[model samples]
Target: MAQVSLRRLVKKYEGDVQAVKGIDLEIADHEFVVLVGPSGCGKSTTLRMIAGLEDITDGEIAIGGVVVNDIPPRDRDIAMVFQNYALYPHMTVFENMAFGLTLRRFPKDEIRRRVDNAARILDIGELLDRKPKALSGGQRQRVAMGRAIVRDPKVFLFDEPLSNLDAKLRVQMRTEIKKVHQTVKTTTVYVTHDQVEAMTLADRVVVMNNGIIEQVGPPQELYHNPTTKFVAGFIGSPAMNFIPARLENGAGALRLHLPEGIVLPVPPERTKRYAPHAGQEVLFGLRPEHLTEEKPTDKANIATFQVRPEVIEPMGMETLVHFWLQGTEVSARLDPAVPAEVGRPLTLAADMNRMHLIDPRTERVL
Candidate 1:
């Protein structure tokens, strides 16, 4: 096993068009880290640079503590699994897994031992003689993994390895990949645009935007405490609700005023942070889960919204509430058992501790 490190790593294309801004990351021995972002965000470029597929225009990349910026991909001691299986149609599973070893002139006994061991680990020993065209999508993926397993490289680089599978199969393969990582514990870096995949599979997730590193942290940390508005809006499923509110002081509590004749009580902690700038205009950022059907209370003096309900969606355990607040559409998650009506007036209270205040000018969490 090896530890991967990138210090001030940068990549630039022709005409000085920057692809990846300086990125500094440390992947400890036997750790699984994921690089995630939206399309055109340069996540794949970063992975390619690390794998020695693309040249590093600036900075250093080290695998097992050796700077290999000048090394070719075959000499980098890394294995990459692409979205496409890239398998030979005529080669059976055994031959496919043994191709790398065969090219290196490994002894016949050693190649057989390695391939068999990988097949057993992947539970594909029974399909050794099956061709790629005969295997299911998930099975072909397993064979690809088997190829990587026999190589026993220091680092495993996966580039959107599950994008082509069906939804159910994708989820199943996700669990299988995690199980494989647990047993082998090789340093792995996975890239994906799917936030759900990034959240579930990563020990640490790096969120990238516009070719620059926006934020990096544990999944829950990024979900609960986002530093930038983009991070807050991108990490959540229903996306965060952004409402323009006036910053004012009312008695001891800082008041959040809305155009719909609704005024919310900002808790002491929140007021303490925003009270100094009373007349400033700010954006109120709240998650859908933070708003509930219950009445607003004073134990934590959270903000409340009274609006006309537009639509309701019942999802097995919980329901989603849709309404208009201050001319902007917003949604809230509530118990599915609650009865809701269309075009009817309703009041929902938001959790104080779960609330976030963002500066409108800078678009940053306060």
Candidate 2:
């Protein structure tokens, strides 16, 4: 296992369109890092650059402490798993996994040992004699991964390896991949547009937008303490609710004045931090789970408000209640046992301690 580094890495196409802006990243040895973002965000380009498939327009890339900007992919000591499960049609799983070793002219015993070990690691020993056409989607993906594992390269690159699988299979394969990582402890760099996948598999997540990185941190850190509005809105499911509000100095304490006469006092701990932004128009941010059905609690900073539900969605364990505040729509999570319906006024509590205040002018969390 080895560390990877990118310094001032850049990728540009014709007409001066920059796919990846100059960015610097240091990936530790044996660390699993994920590059996540929307389409056209330069994630795939960055991955290909690291894999030596795409040339760097400028800047440098180093693998295992050696610069590899000019080295061909085959000599980069990296294995890549693509989305399409690029397996040989006529070759059996064993042959496919052993092909790389065979090309490198390894001893027959070494080839057999490596292939067998990889198959065991991937739990596909029984399918070794089967061809790609005879295997399921998940099985075929495992074969691809086994092929990579048999090489024992310095780094592993996965480009949306689960995109083609069904939802259930995707979840199952996620566990399988995590298990493989735990067992092998290879340095891994995975790229995908799915935030959940990034959060599930990454030790550190690099969130990219508009050809530049917006944030890089652990999953929960980015979720709870986003530095920018883009990171705040992109990292969560059902997304965080953003409402236009005016931050007011209510005598001695700080308060947020929302639409329709809904006002919530800021947590006492945050009053000092938000003091400078007082009397400014800021965006009030809260996740759906934090704004929930009113319940008895000993927790401080709980504020209550009433809103008429505009749309109600029953999601088995939790019901998603959506209401319109002026023109902005907001969502809240409630227990499924709570009776809910459209056009009914429901009381909900906002956990001020979990709230976020964002500057509307710069779109940065304040």
Candidate 3:
């Protein structure tokens, strides 16, 4: 219903702690944009500013093309679901969902109609008469969502709403939230430190770090073609494997020197990016999925390595192999059906076409 835009937004504390450093983002109408990062990375601050919950130290914030930097939180017409649920303990599910409208002095019939509709849509109609104390954790979360839905705000903001639930319930609610968004098509901005949730729920993901916006893109694009080291490491589960390698040769075809007789033969077409850094130290990044146990069938570009296996974990369909490479610990995804032995030396093959080259000096992709 509303498109939110942040132009050079900034927030600074009294103690000179820069909470959010000049971040600019545009979230379109009906788009589910997720702000994700590590702890104290300014993601929540940015969300608060958009919701009018925090004062913007500098820059412009526009909602539906209207500048609302000076507006109050309630006047912003945004509904927020918090991590704590924040349900009234003594109130029944119906009252909890109707509280906002009642406070605004909406007619009794109108409040009832909205509450009933939200409850039905959330599949909590059966529990409408139950109190929060009598509901399970997942049920209470649904109640919280229903309460927000009843408000009928132009924009929906979720501030780590799934963090309070168990892992299984979190996954369930993640799906439910996505379904609800699809039904309502209200513009939404979600904030979380959980990469899995960010990747799964968002239409576009904004990766933040150290009070700055590191990268923003589709989940798969950010995962496969990260623009920086922080993004490459932060956006994926188990993180991307970073190994220090030196470019050993010149322009035509750059060859990277790796430990233990391992060499990465870069394709001629991709050598242009590494042309300036030939013979310089660079970081090689490869996601766990890009490294496989299977032999390379595509001879176009392949990099081989030797890893001393430290841990073997079977995740049903895939096995996770953790090992040490060049004094750094790294993990790889492999076929679970393949027999893995602990403490055994394993040969890992990487699809060089999918490999990433990052500059250590700038931490940016080459």
Candidate 4:
């Protein structure tokens, strides 16, 4: 196992298009760090630079305390798993897993021992005689992983390896991959655009935007305490609701002025934090789960409001209520026991203690 470090790393194209801005990051030994962002956000470029697949325009990359700026990919002591499941059609599972060892000309008995061990760990011993054409997608993916496992490299890199499977298979493979990581405990760097995958698999998730690192933290930390409006909207499942509101001083207290002459009071704990911008417009953020049908027990930090839902979707366990708030659409997750009807008013409670206030001009959390 090894720790990877990137200091002021940069990647620029021929047209002067900067893919990755100068970013510094550290990955500890045996840590599972995930680089997550949308396409064109430079996540893949950063992974490629670490894998020695792309040339760095500036700065340095070190693995296990050694600088590898001029090293070739084969000499990096890393194994990569791709989304396409790069396997040979003519080679059997045993041959595919043992090919790397065969190239190094290990003894026949040693090659058999390594391949057998990896096959047993992956539970693919029964499929050793079968070729890639005869195996299922999930089985082929496991074979690809087994090939990497046999190499016993210092680092493991995954480039969206679960993108090709069906939804059910993707979930199953996710659990399998987690189990493999726990057993092997090798340093891993994963890149994916799916936020759910990043949240579930990563020890620390790095949120990137426009070739820049926005935030890096544990999954729950980013979800509950986002530093920017982009992260507040990106990490959650249904995403956070953003409503335009102005802060005002009301009866020696701070309150938010919403549309339709509605006012919501700020909690006492947050009064000192938001008192400086009493007369300025700010974006109010609240998660869908925080808006519920049940009344909050803490009356001091909860506010009840009534609105007619524009749409109602009934999920198995919970219902989703959609309504308009000052021309902006907002969604609320409510109990299925409470009947939600379209064009009919329903009372909902907002937990003010968990709310977020963001600056409208800079889009930064306040």
Candidate 5:
């Protein structure tokens, strides 16, 4: 296992189109770092650069403390797993997994030992004799991974390896991959557009936007303490709600004045940090989970408000209540036991401690 470092990495295409802006990242040995962003956000391009599949327009890449700016991909000591399971149909799983070793002319005993060990780790030993066409999608993916594992390369690069699987299969494979990482502890760099995958698997998630790094942190850190509005809005399911509002100093205390005469007091603990922005038009950011049906609890900073739900969706464990505050739509999560009806006023509690204030002009979370 080896650490990888990218120093001021840059990638530009024809017409001076910059796919990846100059960015610096240091990945520790045996760490799983995920590059996550929307389409055209340069995550894939960055991964290809690290894999030596794409030429760098500027800066340098180092693996195991050696600069690989001009190193051929074959000599980079890296293995890549792509979205499509590129397996040979005519070759059995064993043969496919052992192909790389065979080409390198390893001893026959060593090849068999490595292939058997990888198959056991992947739990696909029984399917080793079967051809690619006879295996399931997940099984074929395992074979591809086994092929990489048998090489024992310095780094592992995965480019949306789970994108081709069904949702249920994707979840299963995710666990499998995590298990493999735990067992092998190979330094890994994964690129995917799915935030869920990034949150679940990454030791650190790199959130990219417009070819720039917006934020990089552990999953929970980015979720609860996003420094930028883009990170706050992009890291959660159903997305965090951003409502145009003004932070007013009401009687020496700061309060958020939202649309439709909805006013929420800023928690006492946050007043000091947000005082300078008082009376400024800022975005009120809150996640759906933070807004829920009024419940009895000892939790501090709880505030309640009334709103007539416009749309109610019944998920199995919880119900989602959506309402319109002036022209802006807001959603809240409630218990399934509560009978929430459209056009009926329902009291919901907001955990003020979890709320965020974002500057409208710079889009920074204050």
Candidate 6:
């Protein structure tokens, strides 16, 4: 096991294009940390730097309390599973898994032991005789992971290892990867563009944008209380709905004035936070799940509004209701039993206590 620490890490390219811009991060021993962001966000660059595959422009990378900035990849004691699987087509699964150990000159028996153990752990024991060309995409990925496991390195790095698999296979492979981690408990740093994978696999998720750290926290923390508007919008599925609104004083309380003469009172707990922004345009963010057709049990914390449903999608257990709010399309996760139809006015409840007020100018959460 190892604790990976990155201190002001930077990666600069030709023409002065900076890929990673002095980001500091720490990964605890046996911890699984995921770096998640959109394309061109420098996530892959950062991961490569850690793996010694890319030269760093500045700063330090320490693994297991040792600075490895000057060390070659083979000497750094890290195993990486890549998106392309990187398997040798000619080699059988067992040979592929044992190749690293063989190069390191482990005894023949030990190599067999390690390869067999990894195969059992990855549930690929029966397929050891099959070549990479004969295996499915998911199986090939497992073989790639098995190859990494046999090395028994101090850290494991995954660069979108599941990206090539189909959707259903990706989910299954996710569970397999989690199981593998629970068994090995090696320090891990995974990079992916999919937020769902980050949320599901990471002990802590690092959200990056434009080569900078946007937020770093447990998945739920980023989802529930994002520090920035970008995180609030990125961390959720169906994404949070942002409506143009202005905060205003309503008698003794605070209220949000929306277009179409809609008004929603701010929860008393959040009044102090929004008081300074009164009468100013702010972005109101609410998740689809927070807007429902049924009234919440806590009526005091819920506000009702009417909108014409523009689209209705039945998702078996729940219905996704799409409506236009102030000309912005918004989605609501409502109960499947709710009577919903396109072009029909629907009364929806917004969870006032769960709303987010964002500063439009700075794009920061209030």
Q: Pick the candidate with the highest TM-score.
A: 2
Against the hidden reference, what TM-scores do the models get? 0.94, 0.99, 0.95, 0.96, 0.98, 0.98
- Cα lDDT tens digits, model 5, 175-223, are 9999999999999999998999999999999999988899999999999
> Residue-wise lDDT of candidate 6 within 1-366, one digit each (tens)?
899999999999999999999999999999999999999999999999999999999999999999999999999999999999999888999999998888889999999999999999999999999999999999999999999999999999999999999999999999999999999999999999999999999999999999999999999999999999989989999899999998999787999988788999999988888888898999999999999985648467799999889999999989999988757889999999899999988999999888999999999999
Candidate 4 C-alpha lDDT tens digits along 1-366: 999999999999999999999988999999999898888999999999999999999989999999999999878888888899999889999999888888878899998898888888899999999999999999999999998888888999998989999999999988888888999999999998889999999999999888888899988999999999998999988899999999998888999987767688899889899999999999999999988885648466788788889999999799999999779998999989998899998988888988999998999999
Each candidate: RMSD: 2.0, 0.8, 1.6, 1.4, 1.0, 1.1
By lDDT, the better pick of 2 and 3 is 2
Rank by lDDT, highest first. 2, 6, 5, 4, 3, 1
Off by over 4 Å in 5: none
Report the number of backbone clashes for model 3: 0
Kindly report which residue pairs in candidate 3 clash with one another: none
For residue 135, give model 5's deviation from the true position in Å: 1.2
Instruction: Write the residue-wise lDDT of candidate 3 on 108-150 in tens digits.
Output: 9999999888888889999999999999989998999998899
Q: List the residue pairs that clash in candidate 5.
A: 247-279
Candidate 5: residue 224 lDDT (0-100): 94
Alpha-carbon local distance difference test for all models: 0.87, 0.95, 0.89, 0.91, 0.93, 0.94
Off by over 4 Å in 6: none
Per-residue error at 200 for model 5, in Å?
1.0
* Candidate 2: clashing pairs of residues: none
**How do the residues 65-128 of candidate 1 rate in per-residue lDDT, one tens digit apiece?**
9998999988888888889988889999999999988888999999999999989888999999
Itemize residue pairs with steric clashes in candidate 4.
none
Which structure among the candidates has the greatest lDDT? 2
As a whole number from 0 to 100, the lDDT of residue 16 in candidate 1 is: 92
Query: lDDT: which is higher, 1 or 2?
Result: 2
